[model samples]
Target: MSIWWSLHLRREAASVPLARRLLLGTMETAGVDPDISFDLSVALSEACANAVEHGGDERAGVSSSAEYRVTAYLDGETCRIEVTDSGPGFPVVRGRRGALRSVHSTAEDGRGLGLIEQLADHVHYRNRPGRGAVVSFDKILKWREGALLKVS
Candidate 1:
């Protein structure tokens, strides 16, 4: 059996807490252990936070009219999570993907995706059908002595 769940989040910082809680509850009902659930929560929170903070600027009215969608599911041994926004998709700078994994604390922004990378086993970004981008990640969950161990 597989557990699938999703939620629509408005573009705001407050939605981070709600997303974490929702995912936590979903994972619990799906029989995910507490530690694995917490790790997933952190990864999801960072993904959503990146969408809200860097995907577009609220003060600039860029994504003010848009919304974000978050989805998660467990298929066999892998836990999948996706964060999609209505704003125009983020750009991929040439030859910068590797740098993002190690560079942080720079004067400018761009570390949110890096955080997601550190936490998630496999992460990718793509454009949705209509507009905006979807960042998704999958982490392998293993049963270690009958408890869930996040084995990215």
Candidate 2:
């Protein structure tokens, strides 16, 4: 069975875990392996945390209407997730590996992007300047039946 879900969440710290829990439950119900599920959960948490912390207007606090969106798609063999925020777009730098890099080792506040990259098989970042930013990643899924597949 294929599964997909999208969540429109307020830009608040409390909403991070709510998104993570929903993703985890969905994966578990789909018979996703625990290790893969755990990795995706951590990556999702980091993405959600980044959205809550950076996906907002220049104002000092999030307004009641401020929101971010998280979407997940699982088609039995692969899982893809995208997190879109309403805040100002972030800077993007290409790392030596040609992957999108958004963190500095010495910076204490921006480790989420790095963690997401390490955990997910593929990562992409798009900055919309005045519009907003999008962070997307996908991982190949393995089932207990020894069926190997790729997202197409």
Candidate 3:
């Protein structure tokens, strides 16, 4: 079965893990290989964290009205993932970060794009029709028994 998933959530700390867990669980049930599922989940988590950190106003003590839109699909041997945010569009340089910059580094506050660049076969960012932007990535799945890889 083809693996496809999507989630929309407010810009809240609690919602981030909840969304990721739900999507990961769905991907697992959809027969997605574990490694692919894990990578996609990591990418989505970073995207959501960026949105919440930069676009949300959590100081209000209530959930931020901001929303994140995420979609992932596997067609044929290609897997595509998209994460969109309803906040102010990110800066142009935001997508230019290279993989050499590690997100896990203690000094880096913006490493989501870098991680995406390193993990995905292809990555792009563009403004959505509204007041937001969408980041998309693609990779070719090998369809191994335990992991997704590029087909020969």
Among the numbered candidates, top TM-score falls to 2
Candidate 1 lDDT, 7-57, residue by residue in tens: 887778999999999988877766676777778889899888877765553
Q: Please, what are the lDDT tens digits per residue for candidate 3 over residues 1-152? A: 46677877777677778767876776655556678768877877877777676654344334434677778787667778787776555554432553222334454675777787777788877765435667788876544454332233
Compared with the true structure, model 1 gives a TM-score of 0.76
Worst 10 residues of 2 by lDDT: 143-152
TM-scores of the candidates are 0.76, 0.85, 0.70
Between prediction 1 and prediction 3, the one with superior lDDT is: 1
Flag clash pairs in model 1: none
Off by over 4 Å in 2: 59-65, 92-100, 145-152
TM-score of 3: 0.70
RMSD of 2: 3.5
Task: Name model 3 segments beyond 4 Å from true.
Answer: 1-3, 56-65, 94-107, 144-152
lDDT of each: 0.73, 0.84, 0.66
